[model samples]
Target: MNTTYRKVIDRITAQTLALTEKNREKLSACLERFEWAKNDLLLREGQVCKYIWFVDQGMIRLFYNKRGKDLTEHFAYEGGIFLSLESFFRQIPSRLIIEALEPTVVYGLGYEKLHGLMETEPEIEHFYCKILENCLILSQQKADACRFETAGERYHRLLQEHPEVVKRAPLIHIASHLGMSPETLSRVRAGLL
Candidate 1:
């Protein structure tokens, strides 16, 4: 396995579940790597997501179009994992689209293969559970932020926590993700919001 890929797996496992070398090797076997160019579409609307993609470098975004406007839902950069959760679990087409925001390299673990391993490998099962728990927590935090924080507060929190996203994502997308208009984001960026 590539060191970058292995390191990502290790990072995800950090303090959550420890894997034996043999188990780690088995996990690594499930990861296949691919490089995507800037602006490449990793997952399209109506495509069932089959892999959990872990970025080794660069950035990706999950978004959907509504009334012909793009609504950014999430962004993940290096060392981050992303998937269309419902689509991956339910084997249904996703309403969201995923795209590479920069020249990107990712390792994808097939949903079916991983689930199969989970059935037999207790550690893998535990690891999968940990991942889901983390994802749920993060999802709730985002929902809470949207429900309770002002746009400026939300933007500032994002800047403080994931500056990479603010620095790299398009202003329009950032604004959309924060549930505000681009002009609003501009004012917030200027400290006027």
Candidate 2:
């Protein structure tokens, strides 16, 4: 693995638990590097998600089409992780589509290899559980925001929390993620600016 990739892997365990060099090396061995150019589709609807992807650089989006409209569900920036959770956990075809919104580099660990490692690696298991917990928390927060926040408030919250998304993602995706149309988002941005 490259130095940058090793650093990302090392930091995961370093933050919460100490693992032996051998174990860390074993963990590192399971990951594969992947790169995507801008506008690339990393995963399409109906494909089974085979990897848990960690962003080493750049951005990715998770979205699905609803009634012929593209609705962005989430964005993953540098140091973030994303996958089609339903498909990944259940090992089934996903309705969610994963796309690269920028030139992206990510480290992916295969599901089977990851689960095998989790069986023997306590630290990896802990990390796995943490990822799951974060996913659930994020989902709940988005649901709550939709219920409680106005479109402008949602835009502001997103700007505060993930400024990179506002700066780097396409305006259309941002508008959809905030549960508003592009024109509404434009007005919101204009009013705020």
Candidate 3:
């Protein structure tokens, strides 16, 4: 196994659910590695998401087109797992697009393989369930931030919690994720400085 892939597997096993050595071996066999250039689309709107991607290097962004504007939903950097969850689980077309923000390497677990693993191993199912729960928590946090926090406060919170995003993501994409205009984000950043 690649060292990065092994680290990812070990990290998940530690943080999510424990997998037996046999299960881990099975999972390692199922995972596929992929590399994408910056701006390459991993999942496009109206396409079914077939894989859950674990980022081993670089970054990806989840976004959607809304009334001719791009609204960024999330960013996943190294050591993060991402997918169009609704589409992946429901086998429906995705409403969002996932794109590589930089030259990226990811380990992808195909849906069919994941399903088979979950069917055979309860531990895998539990691990997936925990991942979904974390996704829901993140969704709720974003909603709450948009609804209750001022733009400045949200930006501040983002800086504190995800400084990598502030440092690595484009300002326009960061503004979109924070529900602010680019100019507003620039002003907020200037004020902070």
Candidate 4:
């Protein structure tokens, strides 16, 4: 592999390791690197998601269409993981759309290959468990934000969590993710001033 490719995979292994060099070699060998540009579709609805991606650089968004409108569900940035977890794990068609929000470099492992690695490498399994735990925690936070927070509060939380998105993404995109209209988001911003 090229040096650039090795560096990116090394970064992913670092994150996957959770600061521990447990099974970096096993995980590293199975990884593949790919680059994508802003607005490019990484995974589409109805496609069987093949790989679980690790974002080495830039950002990605996961969304699904609702009444012909794209509803943003999740955002993964540098040092974050990106995958259609349900589809990849179940080996079913994906219901969500995954796209790069900026020019991105990613390291991915095919679902089957990842499963094989986990089974063969106990330390890899530990890293996988940690990644899943992060996923679950974030899912729970999103659910709680939707249920209990006001629209403005939820928007605030999103900004707090991903401040770069406010500058990088279009206002409409942020509005949709927050389940609010652009006008409402403007008003909310004004109210804070």
Q: Which candidate leads the pack in TM-score?
A: 1
- For candidate 2, the per-residue lDDT at 41 reads 96
Q: What is candidate 4's lDDT per residue for 67-162, written digit by digit as tens?
A: 999988888887788778789878899999999989998888788887887786777777777777777788788878878988889878877888
* Runs in model 4 lying further than 4 Å from the true structure: 1-10, 13-22
Alpha-carbon shift of residue 34 in model 3 (angstroms): 1.0
User: Worst lDDT window (10 residues) for model 2?
Assistant: 11-20
The TM-scores, one per candidate, come to 0.95, 0.92, 0.94, 0.89
Q: Which stretches of candidate 2 lie over 4 Å from their true place?
A: 13-20
- The local lDDT score (0 to 100) that residue 109 gets in candidate 1 is 84
Q: Given candidate 1, what's the lDDT at residue 67?
A: 100
lDDT of every predicted structure (CA atoms)? 0.88, 0.88, 0.89, 0.80
* Model 1 misplacement above 4 A: 1-4
Which of the two candidates, 2 or 4, achieves a greater lDDT against the reference?
2
Overall local distance difference test of candidate 1: 0.88
Rank the candidate models, highest lDDT first. 3, 1, 2, 4
What is candidate 1's lDDT per residue for 34-112, written digit by digit as tens? 8999999999999999998888899999999999999998999987888888898899999999999999999888999
lDDT of 2 by residue, 93-187 (tens): 99999999999999998899989998988877877887777787898999999999998999999999999999999999999999998999999
